[model samples]
Target chain A: MLEVFGRRPYLVLLVMALLLAPVPFLQLNDYIVHVLTLFLIFAVFATGWNITLGLLGLKTLGHHAFFAIGAYASALVSHYFGVSPWITMWLGALIAAVAGIIIGFPILRIRSMPHVAIVTLAFAEIVRLVFANLKDITRGELGFWGIPPFNPIGIGDTAIRFGLGNAAGSFALAAVLFVGVHLILLLLLRGRCGLTFLAIRDAEAAAESLGVRLAAWKLFAFGISAAVVGLSGAVYAHYLMILTPTSVAGPEMLISLLAMIIVGGVGRFFGPIYGALLLTATSELLRDFGDYRMLLYGALIIVFVFIAPAGIAGLKPRLGRKPAEATKPVEAV
Target chain B: MSSTQFIELVLNGLITGSIYALVGSGIALVYGTTRVLNFAHGELMMLAGYGVLLFSVTLGWPVLLAALATILLVMLLGAIIQRVTIAPLMKREDWAFNVVAVTIGLSIFLQSAAQLIWGEQFQGVPYFFSGVAVIGDVRMPWQRIAILLVALAVMGLCALVLFRTRLGRIIRATAQDAEAALAVGIPSGLVHTAVFSISAALAGTGAILLSPLVTVSPWMGASYLLKGFAVVILGGLGSFGGAVAAGFLLGLIESFSVSFVSSEWSNVVAFVFLIAVIWVRPEGLFAGRGA
Candidate 1:
């Protein structure tokens, strides 16, 4: 298993998971736990985004749309139909996956990076506008509240309740989802599928010449990535129990995702996860700055690009051989 | 629709299209020369908006002088941003993606800074040409007409400089092949800075003209940036002239759609047209015809 999934990253994942496992039981500060929960959710998001961006070399600027789609779909369905969020979340994921394929089909066909960036960004704008304009359904930018949290699971004489001020269940759910998603990602990247993805990323022409079905693989990457993001979005909806078009679907979300990947280490296995954690903490610290928060984020991106192109993951030379491999230049498509 | 309404929409489309042309061509020029799709192009427009407001409104400068000062200031800023931010990143092997990321950061940074400094209120510039021009059944404001005319003149002058000047030759040569141009002793880096400056100037022009029609605000540039991008893709990725043509086409589509549907859906209609165009011809309408 170590050989298949690569030993070092697996070890890092295990260590991080083990370290974080006892937070809820330890009765840590609720704010700390909340931050951790937010970390896990964003980690899931950045990881899913990493599939298309880092692994597949697709510089998509609009993964936030899928996230919003997932959140809204699950929230709307659960609220309107009186169904449990547990079931609706999966339904949301399915809808987002379909949207992914629909958008990805036209998107992956283009070879120009500028065209791809513009198309994806525009598509996200369309989604945001639709959500904002559909005030009757989404409640628009006024905010969508009263969302039902996850139903508690009865365990013999005890129950794991998930609601406001008690984030233990949400943390647990997020932790499980985070671990499950990473494992799937690891498994996916360890096989022939992984090889095809690498081939396509390194050289599309060469991959196509080698009988790699580019469309199928690209769509697969996009679809799975979108589904994961969507799932996280559903988790977010139930956890936060509130939604706003700008909060979930805005371009700011894209900025956050990009900042995480770029600051952590684009294309690196453990890079974005580390990035998500660091950024979440930094954002909390900058919360007092209010308007200056995004300014600092933008400055952070530029600073990291020039000074620490290899990111935090690169700073750790003890990790393994050739730590800078992920930072290598990808061919501009 | 009535003929007068049709004429009004058409005129509105052309006027808006001219501004879009300026914005898109600026982006196209930079992309053509540098191969970097600047995410902060819109921010430059925003900066110019503030610059004009400061000069004409706060400092009490003449409108023409304020406009000139704003354009030059933005041009200088364009050069500085290229030299400081974009140039250094482009030296790296991961320049393509890094440049995109950095520009996005720069864009957000500028927007936030503007909000912090200028506040969130909308500020307007007085119209440069205030009288109305009546052509039979059509009555158009001279300000709007000036926008269309000035944009045409500016773009025409830009074309002349690009085609007829030595600087234009250097720029064109570099765009064609940077290494070849460098081999022949053309400073490609400097040319890139020049292109960025020119692009900023174009965006600045658009902002100045638009300040009266649309209030100058921090978020004002975001939507135009999106429309400019649609024009870029519809006209061809790096084709300046193509972007100009596509800009007019997009503006027309938008105005006509507003006539049919509500104004809110105009952007959707325009983007749909862009997507359809891309689906049918990924190379865009005027692609492969040279920059």
Candidate 2:
């Protein structure tokens, strides 16, 4: 039954997923590729969120702040200073990481679930409003268009024009980001570092008592997550060659992240890809319905949360398979 | 700012805070009974606001009728939400936590549905007054005074019903401990529905009151919902009077910030207050009391 990978069923599923997904991306239409591109981008984002939200079990309803931080930082640098988009993306991540520290310092101070989520929500909204109104820097809600083209993945300055290969290159970049984040997460979550994060998730005071520095680690998780999200935002901006507050702000960013996380199952390394695919794909297909599609999509997630609290990936375990009962810190409440 | 402007700003802050209090009370009530944050509670209020707005503007009904109808309808909806979503969650104790995601999802559903139904147009709902009131040199709007006065009245009534009436005692008993209330023959199931219904009704009241002052849009409830969270955290969760006070405190800070700082900084005041409360007092100012 164990074919060749010699791993568990889910692990095999992960291997197969990576092996099979490229088939569709390489063959799909432009629209499908666009959505797949979005899905892969969310894969990186949700994975970033998953490290803290899924693995560490933190609930952040305001992740858009970090995403925006990355977008704005990169966009500003590329637009004003004529810096290469590639260099600016990393800058965005670093700036976003700093913003994450600012948010985490105060957010981690909160004890309860609702309090933390609400505070984070307010924090993100305030930042978004500021971005929308800051006409000089962000260009306000009017947005900044004509971003520099993404330098294709290659050695030297033989820079390939972005979107030139009719969706292949974009999807390739997304796939690379996805794989990079996925591998990073897999490595981190399997080691002593992961266990420490687990301990902190389980019992903060106990983790502190056990000599694990709570603030430093939590800040680390926040910063890393923010950095990844920033990278996704930067990629999104440069790829689309357009950026707007509405595009990056509010629940759209979080919903996609949350949906991917929820659909994929929390705490599983490969869970985010499933979440990204299902939520992103379904919403994309429904967008043609004009308005109510998002409403219906939102309603579907509510139904899913109530019905499949463990999410699609966690479903098998719920049916007597004994899923990892690793201490899930942030209960939905 | 001038002395008159300063006094008016404070007064305006108090008024805005009062509206925040009523909505905050609704959120706190649901949170108190269920211990789950109902993100849809804002959407419920939003729908209720639109209900009144539509009745008054489109159907040409009296404001009172529209307001009452909206409250009752939303209350019914709340009872159904309790029966369907909240009740079933009691089975799997962990499912209660899922309310966070579910309610957020529900809020999104409501917002988008309202947008699809009413479009994104910011529609006006006329106030129940004729014009602005002139307080000597400083001119004050009657809608602002009415909003504050009604908020105070509603808070008073909520206090009276939650503490004074026999049903109020039962509600209080349930809020304290559901099992103990059940042992005393209080129907906990009915209490859940009742509490949810009351919460929705309060939201409806707040929405109806707010609809006239602020233009009704699909996303109007988003800020109110966030502010309500701030008020509950600042005032002390489940402490009705504390919610009342903190709601005004938020408004006062906001108005003053808008006057002194830029309007851009106004939201910063709310966000800072939220972070401050959660940082300073995780349990809020008066969290555990029946009040």
TM-score for all models, in order of appearance: 0.96, 0.91
Docking class of 2: medium
* CAPRI class assigned to model 1: medium
Once model 2 is optimally superposed onto the true structure by TM-score, how far is the C-alpha of residue B6 displaced, in angstroms? 1.6
Q: Provide C-alpha RMSD values for all models, in order.
A: 2.5, 3.8
lDDT of 2 by residue, B104-207 (tens): 77778888888988889998888777688888677887887888888788778888888889988888888889999999999988988898998888888888
TM-score between predicted and true chain B, model 2 = 0.95
* Model 1 regions more than 4 Å off: A1-6, A318-333
Chain B TM-score in each of the candidates: 0.98, 0.95
Interface Cα root-mean-square deviation for all models: 2.4, 2.5
Write candidate 2's Cα lDDT for A94-127 as tens digits. Answer: 9988888888887777767777788778888877
Candidate number of the best TM-score = 1
Query: Tens digits of per-residue lDDT for model 1 on B55-113?
Result: 99899999999999999999999999999999987877768888998999999999999
For residues A1-333, write the lDDT of model 1, one tens digit per residue.
221233476677788889878878997788888988999999999988877887788888889999999999999999999999999999988998998888887776698888878888888888888888888898999999989998999889989988556678778888988988898888778778777877888899999998999999999988998999999999999899999989998878988888998788777777788899999999988888888878988998888887777567655553446555434432222
Give the clash count for model 2: 4
